[model samples]
Target chain A: MTRITRDQLLARLRQEIPETTPWEVADWLRDGKEITLIDIREHEEWVQGHVPGARHVSRGFLELQIEMVQPDREAPIVLYCAGGVRSLLAAHNLQELGYTNVYSMAGGFSAWINAGFEFEEPRFLTPAQRERYARHLIMPDIGEAGQIKLLDSKVLLIGAGGLGSPAALYLAAAGVGTLGIVDFDRVDRTNLQRQILHSESEIGELKVESAIRRLHDLNSDIEIKGHPVALSSENALDILREYDIVLNGSDNFPTRYLVNDACHMLGIPLVDASIFMFEGQVTVYQPANPAKGIEGGPCYRCLYPDPPPPGEVPSCAEAGVFGVLPGIIGAIQAVEAIKLIVGIGEPLVGRLLMYDALDQSFRTLNVQRDPNCPLCGDNPTVTELIDYEQFCGLPPRS
Target chain B: MSTIYIPTPLRRLTNKQSRVQVEAATVREALQALDEAFPGIGERLLDANGEVKRFINVFVNDDNIHTLQGLDTPLNPNDKISIVPAMAGGTVKA
Candidate 1:
C-alpha cells in the first residue's frame, strides 16, 4: 500500500470539495441564504461553541446523517470542523454520497472565531451525563439537546408509593434535573409488595425520605426534593408551583382532586394514573396554553366531574391490586412526564390509556376538554383550591 | 351488536366478564342492554335522570360519548364501547 502525507491527502480532497471562507458563510447567514451549515466536529469541541445557526452532525455521523440533515442533493450545504481538515474530508465523503453542492468552510471554526464571527455556546453534556444517558443521546428525538432539557427540568410526584416509586426512579435515571416527592406516610412492609422504591429497612421511615434515598442512589446527577407532608389545598399551590410538571400517584379521591385542581390552576401538566385489582388507567391533564394554541387538554374533572362516594369504589388494599399494575402505569407516567419536559412526542394529552393487566391489552380512548367544566371551562368556577376531602364527601382530617 | 368493555369495579356485575357482547343500536341502548344482561349495571352507570354518571365516561370505540352525541350516539355494527370510571387506587395501605 502507498502511504501519503496528511497534507497531500488534504490537498487532494480540497480539489474536489469546494472551499468557502468564514466571511462568505457569515454573509450567507446574515443575508438569510437557504444554506445548510453543519458543524462536523466532535460533541466536546462543538460544545465549546460553534457557528450560530449551524447544525451539529459530527464527522463520525456525517456520512450516515447528512441526507437526513439536507435531503436535497442539489441544495447548498456547508460543513466545518475544528481546523477545516476534517470537514474537507467530510465534504468529499458527502460528494461521494451524491450531495452535489457540499462545501467545506475554509479554515473551519477556528478561522471563524479568529475572524470575529459570533458563535453559539450551548450547554454540553458532561462525560458522566453522556455515559448515563448514552441511549437517549443517540436517539434522533431525544438527542443531546433533549437530554439537556431533561437535566434542566423539574418534576413533582404526588406520592412516593406505588406509582411514584417507579416514576421517580426512572425520572432520576433519565436525568430529570429536579424531583420533588410529596408523601407523609411511612414506608410499611405491605408497601414492599409493589412499591419497589422502599425496602424492609425503609419500613417505618417516611415515604418521602425513603424515596429520596433510593432515587439519589439511582442517580446522583439529579436533585431529589422530599416534601414529607400530605398535600392539601393550603400547601398544594406553593409546593406544586415549583415544578414544571407533576405526576399524580397519590391514592384516595381527596389527593387526586387536590392535585388536579392545583395543576389546572397553575397551568402545569399533570400525568395522572390509577391502578385497581387488574386495571390501570393513565392520562395527562395539560392546562390551557393559548400561546402554544393548545386550548387545554381535558382536566380530571372533565372526565370525572365528581368523585365516587366513600366505599363505592374500593381502595387498592380492599380490592387487592395486581402488584405489578402500577409498575406499567407508573413507567408510562414517567414517559409522559419526560415527554412534557423534553417537549417531544405526542403526550397523553386528551387521551386516556387503559391497561387491563388480566387481558394484557392497552386501549386508548379520547377524552375532550369540557366546555362547561367548572375549573378549566370557559365559564369557570372553583377558582381556588377547595377542601378536596370535603368535596369528595370525606370527613375533614384532624 | 357491539362489544362493551366492563371496568374492574363493574366486572362482578357482568359475571366477571371484562368484555361483554350486547345487542344495541345506540350507546343508551347499549347501557340498557348491559343492565338487562346484568341486573344492576344501569343503576350504577346512570344517574336518577338516567344520565351517564358524571364520574364515569362511556366511549363508542375511541371517542367519548359527550364528544360524539352523548347517549344518543349511534353504535356501529362491530364497534367497541368502553366504560371508564375515575378510580383512585394508586397505593395500597392494607
Candidate 2:
C-alpha cells in the first residue's frame, strides 16, 4: 500500500469540502450574518494574528472542542489555519462528525493578512511597553492586542481606599490608557495596612493625589486624572461619561448606589466589588445590550432591588476585615474590567461571585434581570441619579 | 434525599452549616425541609407567595431553579442544591 503524500491528502480533502476565499468571508462578516469561524492554528500562530470573532480551536483539539465552540451542527462554520492545508483537513474531519455547513478558507490566515482583509493582530508595542508587559504579551489570552486595549481603555475608580488601592495599582501597571480616580479623603495611618497605594510618608496627602503619584511611579506612560471632589448626583454623570468602564471601590453605600445608578444611566460597564470582614463579592454589570456573544443581563439594582436599610450592614470599621481581602477581590475586578475592554472570554455579567477567606471557598450565583427593578427594569422608575446621601440617610455633603 | 449548600451571607440563619441534607422530590419541598431543619432560613429564601426571592438564586446541580421548574423542579437524591444571596455592601470600614 502506498502512503498518501501531504499534497495528495490536501487535494483529496479539497475535493470533498467546500472552499471559501478570504475576501468572501470578510464580506460575510461585514454583512452581519450569523457565522462561526474557527482558527485551527497553533497557539503561537493564533497569538500573532487572526480574524476577529473567530473561535480558536487548535488542530490538535479541533474535534474535542468543536462542540463547545459551536453546539449547533447546522451553524455556518469556516475553518482556517496558517496556510490552508490544515484547515482543509480539519474541515473534512468536522464534516465527518456530522457538521453540515463546514467550509475551509482557501488561503487561511496568511491569505487574509496578505489581502489586507480586516483581521485582528496584536498592536505594535513600544520597546519599553514590551519590556513592562513581557509576561502579558506572551500569554495567549492577553497578547499584544489585549495589552493595547488596556493601554487605550479608560477606567474610572470611585475611591482610593482598600478596594480601589489594589485595583488602581494593577490597572495602572497593566497600562490602562487613562485612569480617572474620584476620591476626596486624605490618607491616614489606619489606611496603611490595606491601602497599598499610599504609604506612611504620605499620611496627610489627598487620597487621589497619593494614588496618582504611586500609579505614575508604576507606569509613567499612562495618564492619571484625579477628581478631588465628592461624586454627587450633580457631577457623577458628567465625570463618568468620559470613561469606558467604572470600578466601584467606594467605601459607603451612598457612593456605591450612586456609582451604580450613574453607570447604568451612562451605559458604561461597571466592575463592582465589596468586602466585609473575611468575605468579599465581585461582579461586573455590563450595559444592557452587551457586546456580541455576551448575554444581555441585569444591573446592580436587579440583584438588590434597593440599598440595604441604613446601618443594616456594618461598615469595615464596625466589623474588622482581613487586610488582604480587598486585594483578592480588587484583583478580580481588574480582571473583569480588562475582559470587558478587550472583548475576550466570558465576563461575570449577570453572575455574582462570593469569596469567604475564613473558609477559603468561592460561590458563584446567577443574577437575573428583574422586570420590576426600579432602575433597569421595563417599568423603570429611577430615571436619573438622585441624592444618594439623602437616600442612604447620610447628611448632604457640605 | 438532596444536599443544600448555603452561601456565606445566609449562613447566620443556618447555624453556619454549609451543607444540609434533606429528603425531598422537588425544590419547594426541599426548601420546606431546609426550613424545618434550620428554622427561619426558608423565610429569607422565599416570599409570602412561596416564590423564591428575586435577589436569591437556587440552583439544582448546575441548573438555576428558575430555568428549571422553579420550586416545582424535581430533584433526585444525588442532586446538589446551592442557595446564594445577592451581595450589596462595600463599606467594610466606615
Maximum-lDDT candidate: 1
Write the residue-wise lDDT of candidate 1 on A53-164 in tens digits: 9999989998898778899999999999988898899888888889999899989999999999888998878888899899999999999989999999999999888898
- Docking quality class, candidate 2: incorrect
Q: Fnat per model, in the order given?
A: 0.82, 0.30
Each candidate's lDDT (Cα)?
0.90, 0.84
Top of the candidates by TM-score:
1
Name the 10 consecutive residues with the lowest summed lDDT in model 2 chain A: A305-314
Candidate 2 Cα errors over 4 Å, as ranges: A1-124, A289-295, A390-398, B9-15, B24-75, B78-81, B86-94
For candidate 2, write residues A271-316 as lDDT tens digits: 9888877788888887675555545678877766655445545566
Q: Which candidate is the best by DockQ?
A: 1
Give the TM-score of each candidate: 0.77, 0.68
Task: Name the runs in model 1 displaced over 4 angstroms.
Answer: A1-121, B90-94
